[model samples]
Target: MNILLWHVHGSWTTAFVQGPHTYLVPVTPDRGPDGRGRAETFTWPSSVREVTPAELAAAPVDLVVLQRPHEERLAAEWLGGRRPGRDVPAVYLEHNTPRGDVPDSRHPAADRPDLTLVHVTHFNRLFWDNGSTRTAVIEHGVVDPGHLYTGRLPRAAVVVNEPVRRRRYVGTDLLPGLSEAVPLDVFGMRTEGLAEELGLPADRCRSADLPQRQLHAAMAERRLYLHPVRWTSLGLSLLEAMHLGMPVVVLATTEAVEAVPAGTGVLSTRPEELARAARRYLADPEAAARDGARARQAALERYGLKRFLDDWERLITEVRS
Candidate 1:
């Protein structure tokens, strides 16, 4: 099938285009948010092609996979007034936890009968009030970076884009205290000045935005992966970290509880408890290795690439039919 989706979330899209289908990504001159084209940092298959909006207007689009709210309108404009779900079969893939109202937030696509709402996590599906919009849960899948864990660095590995801007939302504020307990190597975009901003020594709170493969390798070297996001649909990095054979120290929030099963790693609501867990893992490489093995196994069983692709295939077929 020919799928039309934006290059919105790089990691998620990287896993997505690996499926057995031709993916049409929109490209603009600037390659801005609206039309960022195909991924450059992460290796995507040849099946994923970038086409201009003018080309997309006449291109064969079997199914439109909408990630952001504006994509619906953009799709119509680009398709020469052919709206998604109405003129083309489309599904809005909600990758975020609602922002404005805690649990009372209504999804923008709520009560819309035209398209289906596909959520990456059950927690997102549960929290979002879809009203009459048909909804389905298709959990995240990542292209396995393999079990590259060494755990030589006794520091905690963290992956979050724009930590300073997102701050508490992505658990950037929790890093200072966690760093005091165990050294943190925070990674992702705009992470360069994080150490100075957080008022920590460069070694205690190191930050860098590396390419995907480099990021995975760097993350594998750390003693454990730290996922302190207060609210999110589900972070694919957490799954990728587990796939790298890294024990996780995740905050029990959003879809993390469902993602991180017992024996995989430590899950806590309290920061102090998580900090203590991080310290324990740093102290005991044996325990960390043992739990990391369990984490890799669990991640493989649930979030494998094959399963992810198969689930998407099933949904695309259903949506198209």
Candidate 2:
């Protein structure tokens, strides 16, 4: 299938284009959001081709994969003003959990029978009111970073982009309290000033924005992975950490409770409880290794690249048919 999609979410797109299909990614001259084309940081196969707006208008697209609400309109404009899902088969992939009003969060594609809405998590599907539109939950699948856990650093590793801006939503506030029991090494974009903002010394809570490969290696060195995020969809970083064979300490919220199993690591609402668990993992390398093994196994079973590609293939066939 020839899939038309935008380069919206990097990690998710990285795993997606790996599937067996000719992915037509929109590319602008400036490589802006509307047309970022192919990813530079992550490697992509030749099957993933870049198409300009003018070129996309002429290309034969088997299916349109819409990530954002604006994409439907953009597709229409680019595809000779043809309505998506009506004139052309289309599927709306809902990446994030609904924001703003909780109970009354109406999906932008709600009640639209023209397009099938695909949610990334079951939690997202349940929370979102899709009206009469067809919906399906296809949980995340990650490209395996291999089992790289060393747990030699004796510190908790965290991955959250723009922690200062997102703050409580990303659970940046919880880090300070958790770091009291275990040191934290934060990795993500715009995380440079996190230590100063949290009033922690550089060593206690340091932050860096490394490339994905380097970030994975750095995270594996830490004693455990810390997922302080209280809300939002299941983070790909959590899955990446598990794939790297790092034991995790995650808040029991969103899809995390489903992802992290018992003996894999600790899952609790209380930051102190998670802190104590982090301390335990820091002290016991053997225990951390044992849990990390389980984490890796579970992640592979649930989020392996092959499984993800297969699921997408099936979905694309259905949508195209």
Off by over 4 Å in 2: none
What does candidate 2 score on TM? 0.98
> Please, what is the TM-score per model?
0.98, 0.98
Question: Which ten residues in a row are the worst by lDDT in model 1?
Answer: 228-237
lDDT of 2 by residue, 1-321 (tens): 788999999999999988878999999999998989898778788999999999988888889999999999999999987779998999999999888898679999999978899999999999888899999888888988888999999899999999999998999999888889899999999998999998998889999999876888999999899999988899999999999999999999999999998889999998889998998998899999999999999999998989888888888788878
Q: Which stretches of candidate 1 lie over 4 Å from their true place?
A: none
Q: What number of backbone clashes does candidate 2 have, counting pairs of residues 3 or more apart or in separate chains?
A: 0
| Residue-level lDDT for 138 in candidate 2 | 83
The candidate that achieves the highest lDDT relative to the unseen native structure: 1
